[model samples]
Target: MNLEARKIEFVQEFLKLQNEEAVSRLEKILRKEKNASNERIFEPMTQEELNKRIDKSESDFRNNRFKSSSELLAKYE
Candidate 1:
């Protein structure tokens, strides 16, 4: 009923699990869900913040201080 009780129940049931494939699938699903939840922890930027970032980026471009996409990708490849 409570969170701890539910976790205990889940652990008990998980301990009884016998299927390797099912456990692997469950592990992948849990990991993917955890990653997705973590990615939502950041709040979206406000309009003013967005505009400031855009202006800074334009300034950097005008100053020739930024890398091109092809140049960036070349390093990884």
Candidate 2:
């Protein structure tokens, strides 16, 4: 079956579940899978990349090219 269909089927089965332990296991599995997926997406930057970012930040500060935290917060509010 396709992914969407499979997800619907899974949800239907999950909704009928009567066991707390089974639901807890599913929640733990989902959290673990999500964390692993995030780790893969956000791999640590290299030393060279870190240095480049630091230099850019320093330049922006000297040039007054950045905004304050209050200014940023005000923008969304």
Among the numbered candidates, top TM-score falls to 1
Q: Candidate 1 lDDT, tens digit per residue, 27-72? A: 9989999999999897999999999999999999999999999999
**What TM-score quantifies how close candidate 1 is to the native fold?**
0.70
lDDT (CA) for every model shown? 0.95, 0.98
What lDDT score goes with residue 11 in model 2?
97
Compute each candidate's TM-score over C-alphas. Answer: 0.70, 0.59
1-57 in candidate 2: lDDT tens per residue?
999999999999999999999999999999999999998897788999999999999
Over 4 Å off, model 1? 2-4
Cα error of candidate 1 at position 18, Å: 4.4
